[model samples]
Target: MTPHRPSQHARRLVAALLAGSGLALGGCHADRIVNEAYPTTYQQRHPIVLSEGAARLDLPVGGGAGGLTERQRQDIRAFAADWRKNGRGPVGMMIPDAAAGVHSSPAIRNTLAAAGVPSTQIVSRRYPVDGPETAVVKLGYVKLKANVPHPCGLWPEDLGHGGGDYYGASQNREYWNFGCATQANLAAQVADPEDLARPRAQSPVYAARRQTVIEKHRDGEDTTTNYRQEDVEVSEVGGK
Candidate 1:
């Protein structure tokens, strides 16, 4: 009994050794994390993706037994131009199941045809109307659209809460929502969504311009073209 009791000094030594081991392990873990390849760039975190989607427009039909009004005609013509530009497959029309639709359907078809859309490519279907609500002719076509899959405005982790320590701002990394709005805006504003993934076909070269430049270069003349500035100067005080 009480023959072998560890002294306080021995206990302290054991505690110190354990603390040093823990620190060493923690250092190794931190190094591993730093070395791992992570998606740190905003572009990588929020990528613009191209996918198939629909471009739609609604044309309100007037109750009066007449063809589309002047404004409606212009709107339909513009919508038809868009379809001709980027539409895929057949251009679809979801008309209300009413007499107005029957009356305007032929006129709409004629307008679309006049705008270069083939009659064969125009498809129409009827949707039942419950009551005397406003009837809208829904025109839709499939097209390539760019978007971000991950929705914005979601904060999974509190930016201020740094997971006790060695996280969040301490790591000096981007948050989840960073560059999301930029990516979304770019996707929305891009004229051609497919351009995000790959380049389009090159346009035809300007033969006349190319020939002029070549002639100038061969004749030992300046190849650059200078245009005349015809606009009047706002201020001529500085020897304009």
Candidate 2:
């Protein structure tokens, strides 16, 4: 047997293969240089949306003229007051047509007016009621409300389907449904949706408190406040 060695061309080919592999690895490193990421929770990104609330109030058709009782008048007053205070759009009083077997009466108009709702907003429309019986009157208005279009508690992947293989858990990230219900509840509880958009004007400064602080500072005494703490009863926690 005779000793044999790699030819020049063979050595050159091996070197080319090694250089190609190095170039491929360098390309991969370049891609990783700009791969910065920040995983954000769905709750933080998707806040509650608000809309103008609108609905019609169905008052008894007979609650007009002398037909309206004292209780009915009180309810109408309350409704009108609320609409005037919190309603977004024009508060309208819709009267049923005479052909509907009920006509707009003086009592209905008077009750709304007494509550400070203007008379110019009243309008009338008729719809075919199957029976000749009296129909209910409608008062419609729009109010502010907070809402979220997408509901919570959706699972795109099963938990135990692949032996606890979850992307959120693996990445130490919050689940998609986390804090969604809390956000929705907060939105519904908001009295005014506009408050969420902008802060209200600051209240006037407390003159008495300001004077006390000023006197203390002038006398070289500590300006820190001694807060009044009263004992609060906690019995209600276990009560009915």
Candidate 3:
């Protein structure tokens, strides 16, 4: 039988690996006479880190007394509810000093207290207001955020076609560290890296639903829900 020849893919992979390892050194950069230039195509990926940071909700000045209107009250209630639900650290109130101590700070505090955020858990601080702009009270607390270390797009070394990374370009494969910034940006965009890493704890079960299911099970009836749906108009089902 004739001697079998290595396939094209095998030949290319070997050439690329050899190019990756220099002919002179046998690892990275060694002197070699091989012309194995393929399109460089590999991308580098970065990891995301989760850290604790302050979360702030800006409350703009309203027309009502204390600088809050009915709409503002509703919004503050929602904010307080969120803080009560997810706060892992004490909440802080940052009042602007330009507005004579937020005319309605007391009432706002009361609303927050009623929404499960107790008085003891709240801290107050005052800062100088900017210009004559309406004062804004910033409600903030500690929350988890996704962060990427170091900014992207740093190319100190030359990526030429004659030596070093040039060899990578000759091979059809991607450069050693290509597309790293894209990966880093994607990691940074994650809203909750901790949530992505692990699932949240399940909330308490619905007592009413559980009881209804139990009763149905005892009576030998189906406990599964069958929601009603509107019938689609037959005329629009198909074109004439």
Candidate 4:
């Protein structure tokens, strides 16, 4: 008599093992939350704006006031337009503690609003960390599907996948390392609409820098899991 083949259940277990291995090697950081859980795809396709050129409207840096020349102001206005077209605009603003006094002035609001951004979207908040008294201006644009896949949901890496890290334990912990940096990089590259249409390759320097950033940010960690026991059980039951 011919030997009996392993049952379908056994096959499924083997497949799961292989798939999990592939995910690990490919850096798939799966979150506990399923993709179906999200009610809307808004988060999936959201576009983040990047600050390009020099920052305009210098309030204060370190301890001194930052001066914006007339030419620089023009450049900033132009850059703001670019950001508006590509990213979600005027979402909000951030002020470092040192620049709090100057940024709160009414003149700054009038200037920014006159430049084309709506005043409503400008949210002012204390800088989360100590650094330059930079403005966290909200830029605007429609969301676009990620052209590449990402490992963890936290970041939309060039790989192409998307998801988020759903952890109850560290909900309050600072997870600064997310898709923001990638979105910013992509924003810089696609600042010009023409560049968005034309495809380009990452330079060696860029690749190196990207790798460094990913490592520093711990970009891929969520998808890691252990299904070895399940696989073993299936194999034992099916004798395969």
Candidate 5:
């Protein structure tokens, strides 16, 4: 009844004041209000290692030499197929010798592209080292999650060798192997399983002891790649 006594102009003025007050309050609590009222899409993509950027190539001799069998080539092709599904392809292939039957990086790139992988993802390199080398082929890709579990059983020791110091000073001789396995498993889970299998190689322990020796000499205190997962989370935001 009391409002009925007010003129239309007065009513409009009061309404305008109320609207202005509401807007001011909303502005003060903007972030909270928006967060509560309209949640955004909070998503995280997995990590991948690009062959084009981080790969190294050398002559495949003296510790890098081993001929890839037809079966091995097929396996590599299969692996490439899987990676292509994840919008990636083989970034690099490390053959023992440049003259070996192994295809050059460009050839591998073309082959992968024909098989459906994007051309930008392929890389090829030959190891340059000298003498009785084992054949090593490296494939690179990003990981899907921040933490992935490794399969060779965490911290297993070779009883035949000294414990805790088998690989020189490090407690785990298979650290890099385990680390790679862990990353591979995580990548497999996040990406397609097929792509995860392409770069598969013999376990570090199974490989010739010479490679182990080289790895030990190169250990240099650093244990794993940047993509390697850690035991503890350093950030508090994601409860990580």
Candidate 6:
């Protein structure tokens, strides 16, 4: 018995099916090409990172016979307060040898002590200086800081179309440098770096006010307090 051969119509149908499959595969490949991505959000791309850094203050000393000036004392006090709040380790003092005659380490130490810093927390090291009159005492302490690790203004990928960075150019999204400045500024403006990671604890509710509100609610009265205000007409500056 001769083997039954597929008819022309059946062969054509098989060809059509194979062509459809090829087109589907081509479509999948195209999708893969387009779906390549960099970080979609600026927060992911340029995140604010918390790290240990030195919070430093430079105090310029004038060769005077008197002790620390009022301004200098205030600066030391403020620095001491900041250290008390956020400092991780001892406060370091880079005392210049040139200013030794005018502004001694002992005087600065006393000032720091008066500002509530313990003598043990204040560490001093003498550094050689060329200019005695223009010497500056550098005070610093380790503190937690929030900042963006990646430096801005980098053109790692070409902005214009064409080249190896075709995917970035093709997508109508923000570039690598976009929103970087905003992120950096936000990090700088943050009073406490830790707040970026977690929200602060809620403050205690006012007991008296809460009691008043509860009583008002219980008595079916208005819970909100009303304040007297002067009557005013609506703005008619631009209306007929």
Q: Please give the RMSD to the true structure for each candidate, in Å.
A: 6.9, 5.8, 10.6, 24.1, 23.9, 5.0
Write the residue-wise lDDT of candidate 1 on 86-198 in tens digits.
78889999988777776778888888899988999988999988754667788889998899987988666677654532444677777777899999999999988878988
Q: Can you tell me which runs of candidate 3 are displaced by over 4 Å? A: 1-44, 130-134, 151-167, 171-191, 199-240
lDDT of 4 by residue, 153-230 (tens): 553223222325343123432333345456545654653544555667775676765666677568654433345665
Tell me how far candidate 6 lies from the true structure as C-alpha RMSD in angstroms.
5.0
Residue pairs whose backbone atoms clash in candidate 6: none
lDDT score of residue 66 within candidate 2: 72
What ranges in model 6 sit over 4 Å off?
1-37, 62-65, 99-103, 131-134, 161-165, 231-240
lDDT of 6 at 90: 97
Residues 1-240, candidate 2, lDDT per residue (tens digit)? Answer: 878999999999999999999999888777544541332666564578878778567676654457576877887888888887787666666555554334445677878888988877665455555444556667788887777768888655455646453655575556556678888888889877889888999999999989989999999999898766686545767666
Model 5 lDDT tens row, 1-240 = 455488899999999999999998988787545643321221111223423223222323222214434454455567666565443334555554544425444444554566666765655456653544444445655423223332434344344555543443442222323345545556546543445436656665645656666786687644333565767657688664
TM-score of every candidate: 0.77, 0.69, 0.55, 0.30, 0.30, 0.78
Candidate 5 to truth, TM: 0.30
Cα lDDT of candidate 4 equals: 0.48
lDDT of each: 0.83, 0.71, 0.70, 0.48, 0.48, 0.84
Model 6 / residue 109 / CA error / Å: 1.5
TM-score-best of 2 and 4: 2
The collision pairs in model 2 are none
Top candidate on lDDT is: 6
The per-candidate count of clashes, in order, stands at: 0, 0, 20, 20, 28, 0
Full candidate order by TM-score, most accurate first: 6, 1, 2, 3, 5, 4
